[model samples]
Target: MITYSNLGKKGNLGNQLFQIASTIGIAEKNQQEYCFPFWEYSEYFEFQFKECSSVENWTSLREKAFNYYDWEVSHGNFDLNGWLQSERYFSQSINKNLFQFKSDFEIGLLDKYHYLFARKTILVTVRRGDFVNNPNYFQLSYKFYLTALLHQFNNLQEYNIIFTSDSISYCKKHFSFLPNVFFLENLKPIEQLCLGSKFDHYIVSNSTFSWWMAWLGEKKETKIIRPMKIFDGEYSKKNDESDYFPKRWIEHNENEFKLENRYWKLKVYGYFYALQSKIQYDLKRQKKIIKNKIKDIIGYK
Candidate 1:
């Protein structure tokens, strides 16, 4: 059997999806019985698998798992607590509908947001609630958003440009000057994601919240653009070296990585082989997954 849980900060639904996606991958790859935790937003899903029992007594994997999914680990009872953020863990096949909200909730959103889907919509996801000035995180300059938007639209009048943000005031403050842009209000967090999954194109921010929206919203000729730096500090995932963001997605403001970002400590200290191994050995096997999460969200990007 395999089970997943969030051992990180509470109320982070995007990180929670990564935890869910990875566990589902490991379970399906090995054909093991799956156990996903029932946390916030559990009530929204139409669960297909049996309800997961508490994994408190289960063995935390002892075998080595090099991949993000831990699928390589010998088949045995294990509880998966890794961040497992890489798409390599679960590609298009492993339950694409895993995150769907209840039909009633979706119908309500559709009835209200029908106008958004009517036109060729460009969904701009702005995320700056907790990340505004938190030294570890970042706020994307207005320049990045405008650059991404202008890259797609020659005359902004022809297309529907919409802004959806956790902080509506921030979006208003930065993008309000633009013509014909509208803000979605009074949306619960999950509702926002459900709504975003239907938009035509996206200018995604560093937030994994928006990442999921753009990912779920993909279609033929759909444009998905993101910042070169994901999370500013330790959580950053560089676009060039990683498949953490899909190959099809375009990334803007690459200089942020080459210039302002100083998050990669391995490079900061000079990559001494001895130092790297010491840090690896110092990490406790089970809990080390959490630290690996902080570095690259627990695997090769």
Candidate 2:
């Protein structure tokens, strides 16, 4: 039997989908039964898989499982806690068979939003909350998304833009000004994912939630635009250079969008300019102090 863990985290839909997809892929490859015991939100979010008995402690189970199957199991650079990245093994066929709306309630909600999908629809997912508070996690700035939206509208004026986010307040505060931009509100996280999958095009943040939404989309012509840079700050070094994103999706380079906003340019260059001025001031002060000390020594001599 194959078993997986999320390292005891909760409420991260993207990470949870990655874990679930990876688990399903491993189980399919090895022809073994699998269980995802650590996911506490399984009741709320559902996947198409056989449910095995839940284990009490995932950490202990992970160690023992790896030890017993060391010969069969090899950890790769792409593996996240024994669960490999799904795209390595995941395909449209597997996704069609495995990931689906869990409940009749969600299905009803999907139908209610079905009319929106009748036209050329574009889904834009903006990730905030922890990502905003935590500087270490990479996030595409609002300006990057704004640039993408303008580019998309230029090419496809018919596409209706639907905005979804964990931070609805943040979305309204930032994205409300855009024409034809509709906010997805009052839906469960999984429900939101289901709704997003119905869209024809996607403008995604550097988020697994966005990744899965695009991945689960049924249209063959689905256009996915994602940020090339996945992590914020220096943490980019730790991630695999090649493995995170699918080859087919369009990658929006953050550096390309760096100069897109005059405000951002001023903020970045202004901060450095201020720092340079401070350094110069400190150096001049130190030089004057050293000069005074030398003069005092000469006078004493």
Q: Estimate each model's TM-score.
A: 0.74, 0.70
Candidate number with greatest lDDT:
1
Tell me the lDDT of model 1 at 230: 57
Model 2 Cα displacement at 160 (Å)?
A: 1.3
Once model 1 is optimally superposed onto the true structure by TM-score, how far is the C-alpha of residue 23 displaced, in angstroms? Answer: 0.8
TM-score of 2: 0.70
lDDT of 2: 0.64
Candidate 1 at 61: error in angstroms?
A: 4.7
Question: How many residue pairs clash per model?
Answer: 0, 1
Q: Deviation in angstroms for 156 in model 1?
A: 2.0
User: What CA RMSD would you report for each candidate?
Assistant: 11.5, 10.5
